[model samples]
Target: MLRTLTRFFVYVQTESNLKRLSLCSAARTGSAMTEPKLYRPPAEVRGMTSLDKDAFTQTITVPALRVPTGVLNKIVKSLKKSTIQRPGVPRVVQETEESSDSRLLLLDPNRVATPSSFSEAEAEALRSFGVAEELHRYELKLTYDNLKSEEVLEAVLPPGQDVTSAFSRVGHIAHMNLRDHQLPYKNLIGQVIMDKNPGVTCVVNKLNIIDSTYRNFKMEVLAGEENMVAKVKENGVTYEFDFSRVYWNPRLSTEHQRVVQLVKRGDTVFDVFAGVGPFAVPAARSGASVLANDLNPESHRWLQHNCKLNKVEGKVRTFNLDGRAFIQGPLKQELPGLLRGKASVHVVMNLPALALDFLDAFRGLLHQEPPCDHNLPTVHCYGFSKDDNPDTDVVKRASRSLGLPLEDRCSVHFVRNVAPNKDMLCVRFTLPKEVLFCSDEEHAEEPASKRQKCEDTTDSA
Candidate 1:
């Protein structure tokens, strides 16, 4: 019993030494105790009347070592990872006077508060370099210019509130949808955004939800120049337009490219609600004949401009007409010719808010004569749903608008989250033959009744 107790005490002492060495090892890497914050904004700063850069100026103390210039290289090599690692903070303080033969090496105060904080390996290296065993104090003056946007915002906002300074960049414009609470600091947020992001000349925040009619939301310029024309590049294609007058969502660049990829050479594409020709121009560039149309005159004007800008104007035929008219007129005329041809046809309706409703225009679309070509046009329709089962909800709406059920026939793809409980989705499928070539009799009956008849007709004849 006496021997076992003695062994236990010896083991405890060994464990304690191991822990001290482990802590010393962590200190050498500048990750020891809680770091003293460098960003110190003025107290009682809440909502700023204006961004006061001078108010956030402060000074901080960090542990550093005064080393001789003769052995500076050796000392720095020995310190290795022990040097301070803050951005904009220099590791070595250059000697101001040419006569001075020594410089101060900045050390992370959190890790090297005492002389014994160095690990055994680092300590032996320092001693071999003939360096002093003591750490000196260095005053680091910090200001709003020194602090990062996130760090600055955190100090200004009330504790516990999330910092939402992130914005989507569209050319020289920074577009944001500021929350109600964040509106009070909108100017400060905008200024910080412009300061941090390079090449951003203007900042704007959406005032309300996107307008359903024109699809462009009202926005107020928060900071910088109030230029609304934005030039943005996506998927190697550059487009320029008035951001305030036309609808452009940079987030949908991936979705735009995804649809454009499907249009192979010799194929044809019809962009029913083409806003600035994101789809039409790219598809045209890929050697596919494109017919692009938009009801918004501003969107139509820019669609033509973008097509020319991308040098695909000749490839894409532009039309300024309502979606239904574009469909019943140009699309109806083109579908017959495309049906008889060998190339694949694609119809893109990307107006997410009310695109599904426009699916009805395809019903009895080919009224003159139903062509025999089975290479039906593929429809890529986008919609927004707040339902738990967004996929099902989108498909149902698409089917309802088309007067045909598409639950099993169509493929639903999750696009992105527009808001809480709201999702933007894309439903893709070949336009059903029955819906496309619905006769007078077929149109008289309920769409559900025709689903069975259409299936039976395929089986019978």
Candidate 2:
């Protein structure tokens, strides 16, 4: 069974909209000075007024502070003071930063001391004033510390709160607690689902559960219509999934679209870790012949199904094999003779977080001579920024490992963020002429010092 994990952060503040009411004490029947009678004024006010009983009235101005949208609405409804004049913008009651806790409640002006916990008194106050109903209407923003607190538990509400129903309406849902390592899968899956493109079909898992060997389990659509159901068989075990629980990342689809736009007609595109054909399908649709390969057999099955679903069977070919093995195995023997040295292959490594480990395999595909023909195969290596240094260091390390120059010819394109503090970037370069000519010299030169620096930095982080 797949277990879902979520984290939430909540910040409490005074509401931005505050109701200001003016009330006068009840009149005295007989006394030295009679008190004024209190009366509720109209909802809308024309202008400010002076107190009738006071000889002189003083006006006070207060500074305003921004408050959470959820907290602001509660304040306005609870206070039933008469509106003699239009209410001004709410001023911040207090502006002090506090560490996040499980539950927080702001105090009423009438209260002598603010409550520290969600006590019975606080609950009664909230219930009496109907504040809980208003809170349920808006999603709250939580701080990091609050999200990780033991007392706070995240909850998921189905569309319209269909608590007992299995099938219902489709709407926006939120999934949190995605760790940094799992973000790529989350992002890539999220993109396809949100696109809602008829040409795309995707299955996403909100949970992250890597197998014993550190491989992520494949996602399958369990109980939808024929076209919607995702079928998969792996290691003699079959699993089913639903579309409602899974989320699609909008950013990943945009990136995929960008890559498709870059391709020209009749180009051959290579996707190393082409899980379920996110890259392949788009490339094929753009009129490029796509060679999609993944080590996971389940992924290859989905890739084939996706190709047919998108009506791009003729343009895409799915291969179930390790990326490194595919390059050095059958493809290596067939490429030289099949293309007659005129292959214009464009290799795409979208797995930047782990693409650095495959630099040698990428170098093997590039041409060994100068005036490099565009028809000849070349690599577009992708990787993430080093933790302790700028992302250029990733390019430097990969280039040096492949026995290439650092700055003269190589180009680095920094893509958008795949996760917090991590970016997707591509390094494009051609193999140097010296690659074939100075074999002995290349071997004799010591490995670039930057390679060690990268390993050390990553290890430390």
Candidate 3:
């Protein structure tokens, strides 16, 4: 008899009505609800072993309403907030074993564990529809198979433990930096992450820090395929690179776009340490003439490929050179001509670990003064500092590297915190004439070869 077009379901799940679990009445209007209920696994499902699906199964009784099938659709629409809204769980089920022509509309078990959750507005609406309501009891079984990944993890993870849900999605890979306490549950976490997220086939845990010459780190696969090549899109530009051989931080996408927006058509941009062209590709697409370089050959290859991939290969000139050499060689030669033109000139030093130290190479970079104050190239240099005052610290460091004071001349921008105390910052300033045009005394102190060895390089990023 419950075979009519609409199956009637009434769920009584809300904070205001949880106290009233009894037989339903036609006008059993619920109290005012303050908040919506989010689905959480029953407490009995905690401390799971190997994410056991059977362990999460539970039988629970919920308040229901028996309504005529003719008004089922209208009632379901009206009781939208009162129905079971789980991801994979259906809100409607068959009539009770009594086999009446009416359907038992089950309320959200988590909210209306008992009954009387419908609001005064709901009762008046039902009265207008001329549908009589009586709360019925229904036993429903919930299983782990239907729980969301967050709910599943929350239930199994120890109380007070740090959440491990945040991960960097690089193409199909979910890269996680697991803490010591979470290491034991890494596999379980990876499995759940891959299971819940579509198009994510692999999960990896970083084993070491990203301080290599190439800025890449070693990682152990926790789940899924071993594929390392990743295709990613940032700032509307596509890039494909070998994730293990190069450094790619999804967190820096906003920072990259921030600097690129300053470039206009006919402008010139030098991207030293440009890993896979995150800055260069988009800047070139913006009609700027770009010179992109990276010391890592893999980064260079991918930079060229990404330029072509984004159809900007013709606009970008790719180089495989050290950060300092790119500044001293191609950039030095190209700047003189571009600086004379009216278009803007910009240099992007993005290797946050070493870019600050490389600023010394810009000293005496151009043998002549810029044609005009406005024509001087602006440098966007990145650095990492753990000092309590990072803005002043970065400006001082850049000034030290350039052999001049920049405290009053340069503007420091806080980028992102790389770790607990370490912060990444970008210092922006126009190249000073004093540094670009070196005095005889300053020029004879040392050669580039000798100076490169004595600088403050690091146990850092």
Candidate 4:
């Protein structure tokens, strides 16, 4: 029993020495006791003496002085002007029954040249306050854990290279376009962004535009789960779409709202090339009757789904047809009846890629001899242009397609800049009366040059 008790005491002393040496190791490295140990484990019974030489350069805590509560505030204020108070660490207070008279003052002994010998001025000040030679020792906590994503990336990214500050957020996915230099650190940058931003569960980088026919782009998952179904809220309406299958641009929110605001209750809207009814559903909700059409089966399905989702199915008539067929069929039949009631009719052609050429479909559309009124359908044609004067460019293309001068009759609105030199423009004009009432002779007399030009535009788009 005596031998067991002696062995236990020795073990306890060995454990205590091990803890002391461990703490001293941490202090030398300027690291906190609670910080993660990234280095390999020290050899058994040898403490942290086997740590790499690089570990010694790591930040560690310095010993501090505990001053009386009465002098704590004054000493802290004076220490701020002097070199005694450590940089970056806040002055901490130890709460106790004597809290009002005592507090802790952390100091960086590493800043002094002769760390073993105290400064004359510092020792004199401490001696005046009855301070002892013993100092409070503990690991210093760093503010590194609270850094922002950009700050964390700055430390890891190579010098002279900039990080992308802008990223598109679709539901839980963050879409970024990183340069070639940034690809190497893409995973680390993505993880840091996910950690700093709440509600983002995934990060994806756009590789390139792969499917031009369907407006689909190829993207690779940089971090997190690979769920592409995104729920986006635009212009007060919620839209759920398979981001991988359908085309949804959050940048068009302003344009969608602008056109929807123009239509009053009881107005009739015809949306050609409408992908998922970003305009149609909103117009229907505003009490306007909408005829929404899309060629893509998936987009058509989602458009119908959204109409039901927004509870506007009753007001919207959906169709899956080519833009020209939709214009020459449903719109042709619906216009006369709608015009008889003297209701405002709007034709929305939003496929900027080919909508300008589709304007030729309006030629010889209606054969009605005399519509007792002059309420012609107002067509909103969207197109893309790379000209310096995009407004004039769109108007000229629109006029050439219709074979009529639209300079005086039309109004052009600049939609947006798709790229540095390319822009999207909306040309608003009334469908020409002659084309609406296409007599056989006048239809035959259509300019051959104008018809060929329209065909050329379609082929290019």
Predicted model with the maximum lDDT: 1
The CA lDDT at 274 in model 3 is 90
User: lDDT (CA) for every model shown?
Assistant: 0.77, 0.42, 0.73, 0.68
**Which run of 10 residues does model 1 get worst, by summed lDDT?**
452-461
Could you give candidate 1's per-residue lDDT for residues 150-194 as a string of tens digits? 666766776777763446678999887666778888888889878
User: Candidate 3, residues 1-461: lDDT per residue as tens digits?
Assistant: 23111111111121122112122222222431212222446676556546666777766566677777778888888877877665566667777566555676767644453344566777776787777656677776777667777667767778777553457788898877767877877788788888877899998888777743677777888889999999998878899999888888777878998998889988999888898989999999999999999988999999999988999989999999877789889998887777668998899998776677788887777656443455888999998876767788888888888889998898988776555455678999999877776754565333453222212221222
lDDT of 2 by residue, 1-461 (tens): 11111000100011111111112223323321112211122112112121111211123221121234455555434322310121221222334355222122222222211222234654455566445522111122222222111111111111232111111112132222333433433443233232322333332332433231112323433212224333332222222222232212223545666666677777777787776776787788778888888776666776787788678889987788766666655455444443444435676766554565665553434243233333445567777663444356777767666656657777777555433344457777654434423444344444222211121111101
Give Cα distance to truth, residue 135, candidate 3, Å.
3.3
User: Which residue pairs overlap in candidate 4's backbone?
Assistant: 29-58, 30-59, 30-60, 31-59, 31-60, 68-101, 69-101, 69-102
Give the winner by lDDT: 1 or 3. 1
On a 0 to 1 TM-score scale, where does candidate 2 land against the true structure?
0.46
TM-score of each: 0.82, 0.46, 0.82, 0.67
Question: What total of clashing residue pairs does each candidate reach?
Answer: 0, 8, 10, 8
Q: Of 3 and 4, which scores higher on TM-score? A: 3
Model 1: lDDT to the true structure: 0.77
Q: Which segments of model 1 are wrong by more than 4 Å?
A: 1-35, 65-87, 95-102, 108-134, 371-373, 444-461
Locate the minimum summed-lDDT window of 10 residues in model 2: 6-15
Q: List candidate 4 stretches off by more than 4 Å.
A: 1-145, 210-212, 368-373, 440-461
Local accuracy of candidate 4 as per-residue lDDT tens digits, 1-461: 55345444643443242101111123234322223232212123112222122322334555666788776666665555333342344666474565676767765554322323455666666677776646666465444343444444544555466653446677788777676777877787677667667898888877665242354466788888889888888989988877767667666788999999999999999999788889999999999999999877778888898999999999999999878779888998888888677678999998777688887788867765563446788898898876766788899998878867799998998765554455678999888786677655665433322211111111111
